[model samples]
Target: MSSETRNTANAPRPTASEPAPGSRPTATRRQVLAGSGAAAAIAFTGAFSELFAGTAAARGHGGYGPLVPDPDGLLDLPKGFRYRVLSREGDPLRSGEGEVPSNHDGMAAFAGRHGRVHLVRNHENRVTAKIGVPTVEGLTYDPAAKGGCTSLELDGRNKVLGERVAIAGTAVNCAGGPTPWRTWLTCEETEDRAGTNGYAKDHGFVFEVDGADPRRTGAVPLTAMGRFQHEAVAVDPGSGIVYETEDAFDRPFGLFYRFLPARPLGGTGSLRAGGALEAMRVPDLPDLSSVQETGARFDRVEWVPVPDPLAAGTPIRLQDFGPKGITHAQKLEGCYWGGSSVYFVSSFARSDEGSAADHYGQVWRYEPQKRRLTLVVIFGPDTDIQLPGESPDNICLAADGGLMVCEDGGGAQHVLGVTRRGEVYAMARGRQNIGTPEEPEWGEFAGVTFSPDGSTMYVNCYTPGTTFAVTGPWC
Candidate 1:
């Protein structure tokens, strides 16, 4: 997602008559919530009412909402809740290892013994001056700068039980989801050729890490998963199928993809052995050039398997599914598999015609069973929740059944919460000056997760590189 959409203030608004993608005759939102345990509880009576009512009340002030303050700056939340910092950039990796890498991104949490939780996090830095060069002992990549992954063990109090670096010397480390077998898939979001940095010889694929042993070896790139600007990944436990999103910011839009692992419940070693890669295409809408030109909207989502997964070595082109005959959209970032649906976000679209929908980013939901795609929410070129700027990066399901978005844009970045009913709220704002005069405010929040009990929420800042654990009455 890019912040350029916020600069255009006079774009034409979208009319109700415009055909919205993923538009169903009936309400699909309710069905998604009804199917999941956490969603059912929050989308229904108890928490749902509170979230909506609070949001409606908070909107009366300026465009900004009231702050859900945390005194320790650990975690900010609504009333009757608190938070603490679980980890920070530059913190010691473990007792004697190196320091925690900067630019922390996506993360996943699993149950640990003695009432502790295990977390595997990503550092989305291709190259940075502050972190020196990125390097791993055996891996042939830069060794001084940024771009790495880490695993941590924390107790109920959000105290660090143990921590260590899992992998390093990667590029543009971005968001990835969890697998059913209890492992974390850290995605590398760059297509820089093999020798550019030595880390990406056959890189730009998803890597699996054992949450239990972060220091264990055998971390290999899964080349079978395809190589493009990889963003986030979601796996279907029942089918052992993996869905991926591309974050291409250039002219041609990125794509949504899926990989069916050759072997089910395969070891956490690599993605090379099994499965086939497939790009999603809309069967109904074959041509998208006219749609991109006229700014029309349509719902077209169908999955087509790639005949050869190895074809990833070449520049992979995605089929267009937009209305008016279809033109590619840019940067297909932020994705998650939940409530029997694949949810994804498109950062921005260039609009020579000045269409509102073009400048605004969109949240799309794909129902595999129905073989359909729908646009659930649209954020305009502004700072408000509904009118969010471009660059909607990573997303996670809140304890209250809403969506938590990390705004990776300029001008007062924030962590936004969007409800199931399509309402948006600012859960937290970027702190300008934490404690230093020269250090700028920490923005670009990525990687969000909640404890299994749903009592605590964890968030990470990609720039200054910080992680905080917030606890509240989210449910």
Candidate 2:
């Protein structure tokens, strides 16, 4: 998409008294602090103020607990916690035919009866040789093909109650958002291709699956969500608006996008039938190519709306606004909707020399009311703020009001927690080496979600894939 397209969607307007659809009701100052638990946590860590001197200053209110790495070939967390292997990359297919695939990324949990929860998770494999094709118990997959989805049931104790494959022949299943209606939107991040064997038209669309039924088919791709290298999705519950991030690290990419359902509150059961896909562009920075090539920082940002988001699927170029006003730091990925603002993180940036920015990652917040964007955090290649380059993937909000960032950078991969006050703490470090892209140890921590009550945390690894449950004293 073009810069003009992006800006049109994010144009700033005068602040209005009326809040956005899902904006929380205004609370008294005392209520806000009491609700956040920030003050109490800070006070509990009284010595934290002294530790906040230099790089330690960045370690906000929360501190790291002991790491309980499990080498027994099973996932484990803190002492009070326990985890079950909900699913694995190459487990025998419940469909009674093939095997489950690998590269699991994002996932969502839904409440089930009797204290059970249903999980709908994504497999990011693009039908490769190493990992064979995915097929459900009753379904079938060509031996040569791969890529699919899975559904599983876990009880309160984090034990896998049941498991099954939902869809197959998909590709690059990345981070997807959950709809207010409770279905999981599994996104395929690649365009379909026609080969000698047949046409694979299931790629590059959002497919909604029944979170409860793993064997149930009827998985339909929502063409309205746009076809791109999708990374993550965040939804505004009241408005039913879906905000999505694209993982286009290579070249010619667009900005973050928002989809307004054509039926307003529609798409509960079907996403393809309705919705207008719009890409964001900053009107102030109309000429992105020139700005990026010249290495100029266009501090002013705006959101422009895209006229034709689905035009990408057609042969003709739709609304081509050449790279102007766009920045090299445009690879928008990992977004979570929270705190009256949308928090997003960029994986990395390409420097003026065409080399990747060293430890260049930014956490940005989008204020819907002001239509404003702010740079909340920037990481450098130092010890305190050290970040794996090119792999800052998924993020989740902590009960303590901080961010749980899943680092995807090779060897430096880790699950880092960044508090709202700007303290960074390593929650869990991947077993992978920092500089090499060897098969990620501890897998790439992508999918992260807290239980409804915010007591337990669930994390997933993308390669050598496994899901872990981490519980602690939130009370």
| Candidate number of the best TM-score | 1
TM-score of the candidate numbered 1?
0.76
Per residue, candidate 2 scores C-alpha lDDT tens digits across 332-405 of 67887774566677765655534344334555566565665544444433322233323467777765555577
Off by over 4 Å in 2: 1-60, 68-82, 93-97, 136-145, 196-199, 214-217, 286-307, 312-319, 322-329, 352-359, 382-390, 432-442
Could you tell me the TM-score of candidate 2? 0.75
Q: Write the per-residue lDDT of candidate 1 for residues 1-475, one digit (tens) a residue.
A: 1101110001121122223354233332221122111111111111222223212222221112345544444334444545556667666666455666777789888777788888888888765435522354653244533565777788877778787767766667788888887788888787776556544354576777777765453356677887777899887655667889877656455668878676756556535565677777654443222232211224545555555454444656543223423323466788877766777776555556322235445666666655556555544434343223446778877666666788776555567766544445567655534445554444577888877666777788776777777765565
Off by over 4 Å in 1: 1-65, 68-76, 132-146, 198-200, 215-217, 266-272, 283-300, 307-313, 318-327, 352-357, 381-390, 433-442
Candidate number achieving the greatest lDDT relative to the actual structure: 1
Candidate 2: residue 121 lDDT (0-100): 76
